[model samples]
Target: MSSTTQKCADMLCHRNGVLKCSRCKGADPETFYCSPECQKSDWRWHKKFCGKQAYVFDVELLGSSNPKITRKVAVPSWYTFKQFHFVLQYIFGPWQNCHLHTFSFLKELGNQRIRSDFSIRKEILLELCHEGDVEYVSQNWFDEREVKLSDVYEEDGRLRSKIMVNGNFAPLLYEYDFGDGWEHKITFVKSELARAARPLVKEAVGCGPVEDSGGIQGWNKVKEAFAATQPTTEQLERRQWAREVSGLEERYNPLAEPDVIVMNYEGRWENHEEGYREDERRRTAF
Candidate 1:
Protein backbone atom coordinates (compact mmCIF):
# COMPACT_ATOMS: atom_id res chain seq x y z
CA MET A 1 0.00 0.00 0.00
CA SER A 2 1.10 3.60 -0.51
CA SER A 3 2.34 5.38 2.63
CA THR A 4 0.50 8.64 3.34
CA THR A 5 -1.54 8.60 6.57
CA GLN A 6 0.84 6.66 8.79
CA LYS A 7 2.33 9.74 10.53
CA CYS A 8 1.23 12.15 13.25
CA ALA A 9 -0.32 15.47 12.20
CA ASP A 10 2.56 17.37 13.78
CA MET A 11 5.16 17.65 10.99
CA LEU A 12 8.16 18.11 13.29
CA CYS A 13 7.45 14.92 15.23
CA HIS A 14 8.37 11.37 14.20
CA ARG A 15 6.19 9.11 16.42
CA ASN A 16 6.51 5.97 14.22
CA GLY A 17 2.73 5.34 14.64
CA VAL A 18 3.52 4.60 18.27
CA LEU A 19 1.56 7.35 20.06
CA LYS A 20 -1.77 5.48 20.17
CA CYS A 21 -4.89 7.65 20.18
CA SER A 22 -8.56 6.63 20.50
CA ARG A 23 -10.42 9.73 19.26
CA CYS A 24 -8.44 9.96 16.00
CA LYS A 25 -6.51 7.55 13.75
CA GLY A 26 -3.33 7.68 11.63
CA ALA A 27 -1.09 10.59 12.63
CA ASP A 28 -1.84 13.39 15.09
CA PRO A 29 -5.25 14.90 14.46
CA GLU A 30 -6.09 18.59 14.66
CA THR A 31 -5.68 18.53 18.48
CA PHE A 32 -2.72 16.14 18.28
CA TYR A 33 -3.73 14.64 21.61
CA CYS A 34 -1.67 11.50 22.26
CA SER A 35 -4.36 9.94 24.40
CA PRO A 36 -7.82 10.38 25.92
CA GLU A 37 -6.40 11.44 29.30
CA CYS A 38 -4.60 14.31 27.63
CA GLN A 39 -7.69 15.29 25.67
CA LYS A 40 -9.83 15.41 28.80
CA SER A 41 -7.12 17.06 30.91
CA ASP A 42 -6.88 19.90 28.43
CA TRP A 43 -10.24 19.64 26.74
CA ARG A 44 -11.09 23.29 27.59
CA TRP A 45 -8.11 24.62 25.67
CA HIS A 46 -7.62 21.90 23.05
CA LYS A 47 -11.12 22.10 21.65
CA LYS A 48 -10.42 25.68 20.58
CA PHE A 49 -7.62 24.93 18.14
CA CYS A 50 -8.70 21.47 17.02
CA GLY A 51 -11.63 23.04 15.16
CA LYS A 52 -14.27 20.65 13.80
CA GLN A 53 -12.29 19.14 10.90
CA ALA A 54 -11.95 15.39 11.01
CA TYR A 55 -8.45 14.00 10.89
CA VAL A 56 -7.95 11.44 8.08
CA PHE A 57 -5.03 9.13 8.74
CA ASP A 58 -2.38 10.17 6.24
CA VAL A 59 -1.55 6.72 4.77
CA GLU A 60 -5.11 5.45 5.06
CA LEU A 61 -6.56 8.44 3.26
CA LEU A 62 -3.88 8.16 0.57
CA GLY A 63 -4.66 4.47 0.01
CA SER A 64 -1.18 3.52 1.23
CA SER A 65 -0.21 1.08 3.97
CA ASN A 66 2.82 3.13 4.97
CA PRO A 67 4.15 6.35 3.46
CA LYS A 68 7.53 7.94 3.95
CA ILE A 69 6.89 9.98 7.07
CA THR A 70 7.95 13.65 6.86
CA ARG A 71 5.77 15.45 9.35
CA LYS A 72 6.93 18.33 11.59
CA VAL A 73 5.46 17.93 15.09
CA ALA A 74 5.32 21.14 17.10
CA VAL A 75 4.95 21.50 20.87
CA PRO A 76 2.73 24.20 22.30
CA SER A 77 4.26 27.05 24.31
CA TRP A 78 1.67 28.19 26.86
CA TYR A 79 0.67 25.84 29.70
CA THR A 80 -1.72 27.56 32.09
CA PHE A 81 -5.26 28.87 31.60
CA LYS A 82 -4.25 32.49 32.25
CA GLN A 83 -1.52 32.23 29.62
CA PHE A 84 -3.74 30.39 27.16
CA HIS A 85 -6.44 33.06 27.45
CA PHE A 86 -4.04 35.96 26.82
CA VAL A 87 -2.36 34.25 23.87
CA LEU A 88 -5.68 33.40 22.23
CA GLN A 89 -6.78 37.03 22.37
CA TYR A 90 -3.65 39.17 22.15
CA ILE A 91 -0.68 37.26 20.72
CA PHE A 92 -2.79 34.94 18.59
CA GLY A 93 -5.25 37.54 17.29
CA PRO A 94 -3.34 40.11 15.24
CA TRP A 95 0.01 38.42 15.59
CA GLN A 96 -1.57 35.28 14.17
CA ASN A 97 -1.70 37.10 10.86
CA CYS A 98 2.00 37.86 11.26
CA HIS A 99 4.61 35.14 11.18
CA LEU A 100 5.46 33.81 14.62
CA HIS A 101 9.20 34.27 15.15
CA THR A 102 10.16 32.45 18.31
CA PHE A 103 13.74 33.38 19.31
CA SER A 104 14.19 31.27 22.45
CA PHE A 105 14.05 27.48 22.85
CA LEU A 106 16.24 24.66 24.08
CA LYS A 107 15.51 22.97 20.72
CA GLU A 108 13.41 23.88 17.67
CA LEU A 109 12.83 27.16 15.81
CA GLY A 110 9.59 29.00 14.82
CA ASN A 111 8.28 28.37 18.34
CA GLN A 112 8.02 30.74 21.31
CA ARG A 113 5.87 31.30 24.39
CA ILE A 114 6.50 27.76 25.58
CA ARG A 115 3.52 26.41 27.58
CA SER A 116 1.88 29.71 26.50
CA ASP A 117 1.90 31.61 29.80
CA PHE A 118 2.14 35.33 28.97
CA SER A 119 0.35 38.53 29.94
CA ILE A 120 0.55 42.36 29.64
CA ARG A 121 -0.43 44.59 32.54
CA LYS A 122 -1.36 48.26 32.13
CA GLU A 123 -0.95 48.96 35.84
CA ILE A 124 2.86 49.18 35.52
CA LEU A 125 3.36 49.72 31.78
CA LEU A 126 4.65 53.14 30.69
CA GLU A 127 2.72 54.70 27.81
CA LEU A 128 4.05 56.73 24.84
CA CYS A 129 2.49 58.88 22.11
CA HIS A 130 1.99 58.47 18.35
CA GLU A 131 3.76 60.84 15.91
CA GLY A 132 6.97 59.33 17.25
CA ASP A 133 9.72 57.67 15.22
CA VAL A 134 7.46 54.78 14.21
CA GLU A 135 7.94 55.24 10.46
CA TYR A 136 11.34 53.54 10.64
CA VAL A 137 9.87 50.35 12.12
CA SER A 138 7.43 50.01 9.20
CA GLN A 139 10.36 49.82 6.77
CA ASN A 140 11.37 46.39 8.16
CA TRP A 141 14.66 47.79 9.43
CA PHE A 142 15.91 49.15 12.76
CA ASP A 143 17.37 52.41 11.50
CA GLU A 144 19.33 54.36 14.10
CA ARG A 145 19.15 57.55 12.03
CA GLU A 146 15.36 57.48 11.92
CA VAL A 147 15.17 56.47 15.58
CA LYS A 148 17.18 59.58 16.62
CA LEU A 149 14.25 61.77 15.60
CA SER A 150 12.27 60.29 18.50
CA ASP A 151 13.39 60.21 22.11
CA VAL A 152 13.41 56.41 22.33
CA TYR A 153 16.41 56.21 24.65
CA GLU A 154 15.16 58.35 27.51
CA GLU A 155 14.90 55.12 29.60
CA ASP A 156 12.26 56.76 31.81
CA GLY A 157 9.55 56.45 29.12
CA ARG A 158 8.40 53.95 26.46
CA LEU A 159 8.18 54.25 22.69
CA ARG A 160 4.82 54.56 20.94
CA SER A 161 4.76 51.33 18.92
CA LYS A 162 1.78 49.01 19.53
CA ILE A 163 -0.17 51.38 21.75
CA MET A 164 -2.73 51.61 18.98
CA VAL A 165 -3.31 47.89 18.55
CA ASN A 166 -3.67 46.73 22.14
CA GLY A 167 -6.40 48.93 23.55
CA ASN A 168 -5.32 48.50 27.17
CA PHE A 169 -1.50 48.44 26.88
CA ALA A 170 -1.40 50.35 23.60
CA PRO A 171 1.74 50.90 21.53
CA LEU A 172 4.09 47.93 21.38
CA LEU A 173 7.58 49.29 22.00
CA TYR A 174 6.95 49.46 25.77
CA GLU A 175 8.93 47.05 27.98
CA TYR A 176 8.45 45.19 31.28
CA ASP A 177 10.30 42.99 33.79
CA PHE A 178 8.19 40.08 35.18
CA GLY A 179 10.93 38.72 37.40
CA ASP A 180 14.38 37.12 37.38
CA GLY A 181 12.97 34.21 35.35
CA TRP A 182 11.58 36.15 32.38
CA GLU A 183 13.19 37.95 29.45
CA HIS A 184 12.11 41.59 29.36
CA LYS A 185 11.10 42.64 25.82
CA ILE A 186 9.01 45.33 24.18
CA THR A 187 5.31 44.71 23.43
CA PHE A 188 2.98 45.89 20.63
CA VAL A 189 3.91 46.96 17.06
CA LYS A 190 1.94 49.49 15.02
CA SER A 191 3.91 49.85 11.80
CA GLU A 192 4.89 46.82 9.74
CA LEU A 193 6.63 44.22 11.91
CA ALA A 194 8.26 42.18 9.13
CA ARG A 195 8.24 43.92 5.74
CA ALA A 196 10.35 41.32 3.95
CA ALA A 197 8.67 38.50 5.87
CA ARG A 198 5.26 39.85 4.91
CA PRO A 199 4.35 36.77 2.93
CA LEU A 200 5.03 34.45 5.86
CA VAL A 201 2.99 36.66 8.19
CA LYS A 202 0.11 36.75 5.72
CA GLU A 203 0.11 32.96 5.65
CA ALA A 204 0.04 32.99 9.45
CA VAL A 205 -3.08 35.14 9.53
CA GLY A 206 -6.19 34.08 11.50
CA CYS A 207 -4.17 31.89 13.82
CA GLY A 208 -4.67 33.97 16.99
CA PRO A 209 -6.82 36.65 18.63
CA VAL A 210 -9.65 34.17 19.00
CA GLU A 211 -12.95 35.95 19.39
CA ASP A 212 -15.23 34.65 22.14
CA SER A 213 -17.46 33.28 19.41
CA GLY A 214 -14.81 31.56 17.30
CA GLY A 215 -12.74 28.42 17.89
CA ILE A 216 -14.46 25.07 17.31
CA GLN A 217 -15.51 25.95 20.89
CA GLY A 218 -11.85 25.95 21.92
CA TRP A 219 -11.84 29.72 22.43
CA ASN A 220 -14.74 29.95 24.86
CA LYS A 221 -13.62 26.72 26.50
CA VAL A 222 -10.20 28.21 27.16
CA LYS A 223 -11.82 31.32 28.61
CA GLU A 224 -13.65 29.11 31.08
CA ALA A 225 -10.51 27.12 31.75
CA PHE A 226 -8.50 30.28 32.42
CA ALA A 227 -11.09 31.51 34.85
CA ALA A 228 -11.13 28.16 36.61
CA THR A 229 -7.40 28.11 37.44
CA GLN A 230 -7.48 29.98 40.73
CA PRO A 231 -9.82 30.01 43.72
CA THR A 232 -10.85 33.50 44.82
CA THR A 233 -9.39 35.12 47.94
CA GLU A 234 -12.73 34.80 49.72
CA GLN A 235 -12.93 31.14 48.82
CA LEU A 236 -9.49 30.31 50.12
CA GLU A 237 -9.79 32.41 53.26
CA ARG A 238 -13.19 30.93 54.04
CA ARG A 239 -11.82 27.43 53.76
CA GLN A 240 -8.88 28.30 55.98
CA TRP A 241 -11.18 29.88 58.53
CA ALA A 242 -13.34 26.77 58.62
CA ARG A 243 -10.33 24.62 59.55
CA GLU A 244 -9.24 27.11 62.17
CA VAL A 245 -12.70 27.15 63.70
CA SER A 246 -12.75 23.35 63.81
CA GLY A 247 -9.40 23.32 65.62
CA LEU A 248 -10.64 25.89 68.13
CA GLU A 249 -13.71 23.76 68.75
CA GLU A 250 -11.51 20.81 69.66
CA ARG A 251 -9.58 22.99 72.12
CA TYR A 252 -12.75 24.22 73.82
CA ASN A 253 -12.80 24.55 77.62
CA PRO A 254 -15.90 25.52 79.49
CA LEU A 255 -13.78 26.50 82.47
CA ALA A 256 -12.02 29.38 80.66
CA GLU A 257 -12.80 32.84 82.06
CA PRO A 258 -15.19 35.05 80.01
CA ASP A 259 -12.72 37.97 79.99
CA VAL A 260 -9.96 35.85 78.44
CA ILE A 261 -12.30 34.57 75.70
CA VAL A 262 -13.51 38.11 74.94
CA MET A 263 -9.93 39.41 74.58
CA ASN A 264 -8.98 36.61 72.16
CA TYR A 265 -11.94 37.32 69.87
CA GLU A 266 -11.29 41.10 70.01
CA GLY A 267 -7.81 40.81 68.50
CA ARG A 268 -8.73 38.12 65.94
CA TRP A 269 -9.71 40.48 63.10
CA GLU A 270 -6.45 42.46 63.07
CA ASN A 271 -6.08 41.12 59.52
CA HIS A 272 -8.36 43.86 58.15
CA GLU A 273 -6.47 46.77 59.73
CA GLU A 274 -5.37 49.32 57.12
CA GLY A 275 -4.01 52.25 59.22
CA TYR A 276 -1.86 50.72 61.88
CA ARG A 277 1.93 50.84 62.21
CA GLU A 278 3.48 48.62 64.87
CA ASP A 279 4.83 45.09 65.15
CA GLU A 280 7.09 43.09 62.84
CA ARG A 281 4.83 40.03 62.24
CA ARG A 282 1.32 41.50 62.31
CA ARG A 283 1.45 43.29 58.97
CA THR A 284 -0.13 42.23 55.68
CA ALA A 285 1.55 43.58 52.54
CA PHE A 286 -1.50 43.77 50.33
Candidate 2:
Protein backbone atom coordinates (compact mmCIF):
# COMPACT_ATOMS: atom_id res chain seq x y z
CA MET A 1 0.00 0.00 0.00
CA SER A 2 1.08 3.59 -0.65
CA SER A 3 1.58 6.17 2.03
CA THR A 4 -1.63 7.35 3.59
CA THR A 5 -0.20 10.73 4.59
CA GLN A 6 0.01 11.94 1.02
CA LYS A 7 -2.65 12.45 -1.61
CA CYS A 8 -2.67 11.10 -5.17
CA ALA A 9 -0.11 12.56 -7.56
CA ASP A 10 -2.75 13.39 -10.12
CA MET A 11 -3.52 17.11 -10.21
CA LEU A 12 -7.22 16.53 -10.63
CA CYS A 13 -7.47 13.86 -7.95
CA HIS A 14 -6.59 14.53 -4.32
CA ARG A 15 -7.84 11.27 -2.88
CA ASN A 16 -5.35 9.05 -1.01
CA GLY A 17 -3.71 6.48 -3.27
CA VAL A 18 -3.91 2.76 -2.65
CA LEU A 19 -1.35 1.76 -5.27
CA LYS A 20 2.11 3.10 -6.07
CA CYS A 21 3.69 3.35 -9.53
CA SER A 22 5.96 0.33 -10.02
CA ARG A 23 8.39 2.18 -12.25
CA CYS A 24 8.95 4.95 -9.69
CA LYS A 25 8.69 2.82 -6.59
CA GLY A 26 12.09 3.76 -5.20
CA ALA A 27 12.08 7.37 -6.30
CA ASP A 28 12.29 9.96 -3.59
CA PRO A 29 8.88 11.38 -2.76
CA GLU A 30 7.41 8.50 -4.75
CA THR A 31 4.27 8.87 -6.82
CA PHE A 32 1.01 7.18 -5.89
CA TYR A 33 -2.25 6.51 -7.68
CA CYS A 34 -5.67 5.73 -6.26
CA SER A 35 -6.37 3.39 -9.16
CA PRO A 36 -5.12 2.33 -12.60
CA GLU A 37 -7.59 4.71 -14.23
CA CYS A 38 -6.17 7.71 -12.40
CA GLN A 39 -2.61 6.63 -13.15
CA LYS A 40 -3.38 6.18 -16.83
CA SER A 41 -4.93 9.63 -16.99
CA ASP A 42 -1.76 11.18 -15.47
CA TRP A 43 0.67 9.18 -17.63
CA ARG A 44 1.29 12.09 -20.01
CA TRP A 45 2.90 14.15 -17.26
CA HIS A 46 4.35 11.29 -15.20
CA LYS A 47 6.16 9.62 -18.08
CA LYS A 48 8.63 12.48 -18.18
CA PHE A 49 9.83 11.62 -14.69
CA CYS A 50 9.36 7.84 -14.52
CA GLY A 51 11.64 7.73 -11.46
CA LYS A 52 14.26 10.39 -12.17
CA GLN A 53 15.04 13.28 -9.84
CA ALA A 54 14.75 17.02 -10.49
CA TYR A 55 17.67 19.41 -10.89
CA VAL A 56 18.34 23.12 -10.46
CA PHE A 57 20.61 24.95 -12.89
CA ASP A 58 22.29 28.31 -13.19
CA VAL A 59 21.97 29.40 -16.85
CA GLU A 60 24.05 32.45 -17.73
CA LEU A 61 24.13 34.19 -21.09
CA LEU A 62 27.75 34.65 -22.15
CA GLY A 63 29.38 37.39 -24.32
CA SER A 64 26.69 39.92 -23.48
CA SER A 65 27.98 43.51 -23.47
CA ASN A 66 25.55 44.33 -20.68
CA PRO A 67 25.97 43.18 -17.07
CA LYS A 68 26.00 39.40 -16.61
CA ILE A 69 22.54 38.04 -17.48
CA THR A 70 21.62 34.81 -15.64
CA ARG A 71 18.66 32.74 -14.60
CA LYS A 72 18.43 30.12 -11.83
CA VAL A 73 15.74 27.60 -12.59
CA ALA A 74 14.39 24.23 -11.42
CA VAL A 75 13.53 21.66 -14.07
CA PRO A 76 12.62 17.99 -14.06
CA SER A 77 15.18 15.52 -15.38
CA TRP A 78 12.56 14.06 -17.71
CA TYR A 79 12.27 17.33 -19.64
CA THR A 80 13.45 16.93 -23.22
CA PHE A 81 16.08 19.20 -24.72
CA LYS A 82 13.31 20.82 -26.75
CA GLN A 83 11.39 21.62 -23.58
CA PHE A 84 14.55 23.04 -22.06
CA HIS A 85 14.92 25.19 -25.18
CA PHE A 86 11.49 26.67 -24.59
CA VAL A 87 12.44 27.41 -20.99
CA LEU A 88 15.49 29.32 -22.18
CA GLN A 89 13.41 31.23 -24.73
CA TYR A 90 10.98 32.29 -22.04
CA ILE A 91 13.55 33.51 -19.53
CA PHE A 92 15.96 35.17 -21.89
CA GLY A 93 14.58 38.33 -23.56
CA PRO A 94 11.28 36.50 -23.17
CA TRP A 95 12.78 35.85 -26.55
CA GLN A 96 10.80 35.33 -29.69
CA ASN A 97 11.76 31.88 -31.07
CA CYS A 98 12.62 33.01 -34.57
CA HIS A 99 15.95 31.26 -35.10
CA LEU A 100 17.81 27.97 -34.91
CA HIS A 101 19.38 26.63 -31.69
CA THR A 102 21.67 23.85 -30.47
CA PHE A 103 23.13 22.48 -27.21
CA SER A 104 26.76 21.39 -27.07
CA PHE A 105 28.52 19.20 -24.54
CA LEU A 106 32.27 19.41 -23.96
CA LYS A 107 34.16 16.55 -22.36
CA GLU A 108 37.56 16.53 -20.71
CA LEU A 109 40.24 14.55 -22.52
CA GLY A 110 43.30 13.65 -20.39
CA ASN A 111 44.64 16.85 -18.67
CA GLN A 112 43.56 19.17 -21.48
CA ARG A 113 41.20 21.09 -19.10
CA ILE A 114 38.30 20.82 -21.61
CA ARG A 115 39.06 24.07 -23.48
CA SER A 116 37.87 24.81 -27.01
CA ASP A 117 40.38 22.38 -28.55
CA PHE A 118 38.84 19.19 -27.17
CA SER A 119 38.84 16.46 -29.80
CA ILE A 120 35.67 14.90 -28.41
CA ARG A 121 32.40 16.83 -28.31
CA LYS A 122 28.70 16.16 -28.93
CA GLU A 123 26.06 18.47 -30.35
CA ILE A 124 22.28 18.17 -30.05
CA LEU A 125 20.77 19.93 -33.00
CA LEU A 126 17.27 21.42 -33.26
CA GLU A 127 16.46 18.77 -35.83
CA LEU A 128 18.19 15.50 -36.61
CA CYS A 129 17.23 15.56 -40.28
CA HIS A 130 14.60 17.52 -42.15
CA GLU A 131 13.56 17.35 -45.78
CA GLY A 132 15.86 20.17 -46.88
CA ASP A 133 18.44 19.69 -44.09
CA VAL A 134 21.81 18.11 -44.72
CA GLU A 135 22.20 14.61 -43.29
CA TYR A 136 24.44 14.19 -40.21
CA VAL A 137 24.79 10.43 -39.72
CA SER A 138 27.39 10.66 -36.99
CA GLN A 139 26.41 9.73 -33.41
CA ASN A 140 27.75 13.10 -32.28
CA TRP A 141 24.68 14.89 -33.58
CA PHE A 142 21.20 14.21 -32.11
CA ASP A 143 17.70 15.58 -32.36
CA GLU A 144 16.70 17.87 -29.50
CA ARG A 145 13.31 16.19 -29.09
CA GLU A 146 14.91 12.75 -28.71
CA VAL A 147 17.18 13.70 -25.81
CA LYS A 148 16.29 14.40 -22.20
CA LEU A 149 18.21 16.27 -19.51
CA SER A 150 18.71 12.96 -17.67
CA ASP A 151 20.39 11.38 -20.71
CA VAL A 152 23.19 13.95 -20.54
CA TYR A 153 23.42 14.37 -16.78
CA GLU A 154 23.30 10.76 -15.72
CA GLU A 155 23.55 9.26 -12.19
CA ASP A 156 20.56 11.29 -11.05
CA GLY A 157 22.12 14.68 -11.85
CA ARG A 158 25.35 13.93 -9.96
CA LEU A 159 27.45 13.80 -13.14
CA ARG A 160 28.53 17.42 -12.65
CA SER A 161 29.46 16.91 -9.00
CA LYS A 162 31.71 14.00 -9.98
CA ILE A 163 33.38 16.07 -12.72
CA MET A 164 33.93 19.14 -10.53
CA VAL A 165 37.47 20.45 -10.96
CA ASN A 166 38.89 23.11 -8.67
CA GLY A 167 35.46 23.55 -7.14
CA ASN A 168 33.82 24.39 -10.49
CA PHE A 169 31.45 22.15 -12.41
CA ALA A 170 31.83 21.83 -16.17
CA PRO A 171 29.14 23.80 -17.96
CA LEU A 172 26.85 22.63 -20.77
CA LEU A 173 26.80 25.15 -23.62
CA TYR A 174 23.67 26.26 -25.47
CA GLU A 175 23.71 28.45 -28.58
CA TYR A 176 20.71 30.19 -30.10
CA ASP A 177 20.62 32.04 -33.42
CA PHE A 178 23.80 30.90 -35.09
CA GLY A 179 24.31 34.31 -36.72
CA ASP A 180 24.04 36.38 -33.51
CA GLY A 181 25.68 33.62 -31.44
CA TRP A 182 23.67 33.95 -28.24
CA GLU A 183 25.65 31.52 -26.09
CA HIS A 184 24.75 30.43 -22.58
CA LYS A 185 26.65 28.38 -20.00
CA ILE A 186 24.47 25.95 -18.08
CA THR A 187 25.99 24.84 -14.75
CA PHE A 188 24.46 22.40 -12.34
CA VAL A 189 23.53 23.79 -8.93
CA LYS A 190 21.89 20.91 -7.03
CA SER A 191 19.21 18.25 -7.08
CA GLU A 192 15.69 19.08 -5.94
CA LEU A 193 12.50 17.20 -5.01
CA ALA A 194 9.75 17.19 -7.59
CA ARG A 195 7.34 19.99 -6.82
CA ALA A 196 5.92 21.35 -10.03
CA ALA A 197 5.25 19.85 -13.44
CA ARG A 198 6.38 23.08 -15.13
CA PRO A 199 9.75 24.75 -14.91
CA LEU A 200 10.01 27.31 -12.11
CA VAL A 201 12.13 30.44 -12.03
CA LYS A 202 14.20 30.49 -8.83
CA GLU A 203 16.05 33.73 -9.68
CA ALA A 204 16.61 36.12 -12.61
CA VAL A 205 18.92 39.02 -13.35
CA GLY A 206 19.29 41.61 -16.14
CA CYS A 207 17.04 41.83 -19.16
CA GLY A 208 17.65 39.58 -22.20
CA PRO A 209 18.78 41.10 -25.47
CA VAL A 210 16.13 42.16 -27.95
CA GLU A 211 15.69 39.90 -30.98
CA ASP A 212 17.33 40.99 -34.28
CA SER A 213 19.34 43.56 -32.33
CA GLY A 214 22.49 42.09 -33.82
CA GLY A 215 24.83 40.64 -31.22
CA ILE A 216 26.42 42.18 -28.16
CA GLN A 217 27.97 45.02 -30.17
CA GLY A 218 24.69 45.85 -31.87
CA TRP A 219 22.81 45.73 -28.56
CA ASN A 220 25.33 48.16 -27.07
CA LYS A 221 24.66 50.55 -29.93
CA VAL A 222 20.94 50.41 -29.24
CA LYS A 223 21.62 51.21 -25.59
CA GLU A 224 23.81 54.11 -26.57
CA ALA A 225 21.13 55.55 -28.81
CA PHE A 226 18.49 55.38 -26.07
CA ALA A 227 20.86 56.83 -23.45
CA ALA A 228 21.94 59.75 -25.60
CA THR A 229 20.64 63.18 -24.52
CA GLN A 230 21.43 64.69 -27.90
CA PRO A 231 20.93 62.02 -30.51
CA THR A 232 22.90 61.76 -33.74
CA THR A 233 21.19 60.73 -36.96
CA GLU A 234 22.65 57.23 -36.69
CA GLN A 235 21.52 57.00 -33.06
CA LEU A 236 17.95 58.05 -33.97
CA GLU A 237 17.82 55.46 -36.72
CA ARG A 238 19.15 52.78 -34.40
CA ARG A 239 16.52 53.63 -31.78
CA GLN A 240 13.77 53.38 -34.38
CA TRP A 241 15.12 50.07 -35.53
CA ALA A 242 15.19 48.67 -31.99
CA ARG A 243 11.62 49.75 -31.33
CA GLU A 244 10.42 48.36 -34.63
CA VAL A 245 12.11 44.98 -34.15
CA SER A 246 10.97 44.60 -30.53
CA GLY A 247 7.47 45.90 -31.24
CA LEU A 248 7.84 48.39 -28.44
CA GLU A 249 6.05 51.73 -28.65
CA GLU A 250 8.58 53.45 -26.38
CA ARG A 251 12.35 53.59 -26.23
CA TYR A 252 14.04 50.32 -25.28
CA ASN A 253 15.63 50.41 -21.85
CA PRO A 254 18.39 47.85 -21.63
CA LEU A 255 18.64 48.21 -17.86
CA ALA A 256 15.00 47.44 -17.18
CA GLU A 257 14.47 44.65 -14.61
CA PRO A 258 13.26 41.28 -15.94
CA ASP A 259 9.86 40.11 -14.78
CA VAL A 260 10.27 36.60 -13.34
CA ILE A 261 6.53 36.07 -12.98
CA VAL A 262 5.92 36.90 -16.62
CA MET A 263 8.84 34.72 -17.70
CA ASN A 264 7.41 31.67 -15.91
CA TYR A 265 4.15 31.85 -17.83
CA GLU A 266 3.79 30.53 -21.39
CA GLY A 267 1.48 33.06 -23.07
CA ARG A 268 1.60 36.83 -23.50
CA TRP A 269 2.92 38.94 -20.63
CA GLU A 270 -0.50 40.56 -20.06
CA ASN A 271 -2.01 37.32 -18.67
CA HIS A 272 1.00 36.24 -16.61
CA GLU A 273 -0.43 37.32 -13.28
CA GLU A 274 -3.63 35.39 -13.87
CA GLY A 275 -1.72 32.31 -15.00
CA TYR A 276 0.47 32.46 -11.93
CA ARG A 277 -2.53 32.73 -9.63
CA GLU A 278 -4.20 29.74 -11.27
CA ASP A 279 -1.03 27.66 -10.91
CA GLU A 280 -0.77 28.58 -7.26
CA ARG A 281 -4.38 27.59 -6.63
CA ARG A 282 -3.80 24.20 -8.20
CA ARG A 283 -0.59 23.66 -6.25
CA THR A 284 -2.22 24.49 -2.94
CA ALA A 285 -5.41 22.59 -3.61
CA PHE A 286 -3.66 19.25 -3.04
C-alpha RMSD for every candidate: 24.7, 9.8
**Tens digit per residue, CA lDDT, model 2, 105-219:** 5442222212233343332212221122222333545666677777656665523343345655455777677677677778888877654566778788887888877877777
lDDT for model 1 comes to 0.25
What are the per-residue Cα lDDT tens digits for candidate 1 across 1-286?
Answer: 1233444333445543224334334233333434445446654543433322211111000111112111111112212212222222222222121111111111111123221333222122222212232321222223222232122322221343322233333222211111111121322222211111001111111122122223223322333332344856754443344334324433422122223222223132132121112221232242
Q: Which portions of model 1 miss their true places by more than 4 Å?
A: 1-45, 48-162, 165-170, 177-285
Measured by lDDT, the strongest candidate is 2
Q: What are the models' TM-scores?
A: 0.17, 0.64
Q: Clashes per prediction? A: 43, 0
Badly placed stretches (over 4 Å) of model 2 are 1-52, 108-139, 156-169, 265-286
Q: What is the C-alpha lDDT of each candidate?
A: 0.25, 0.66
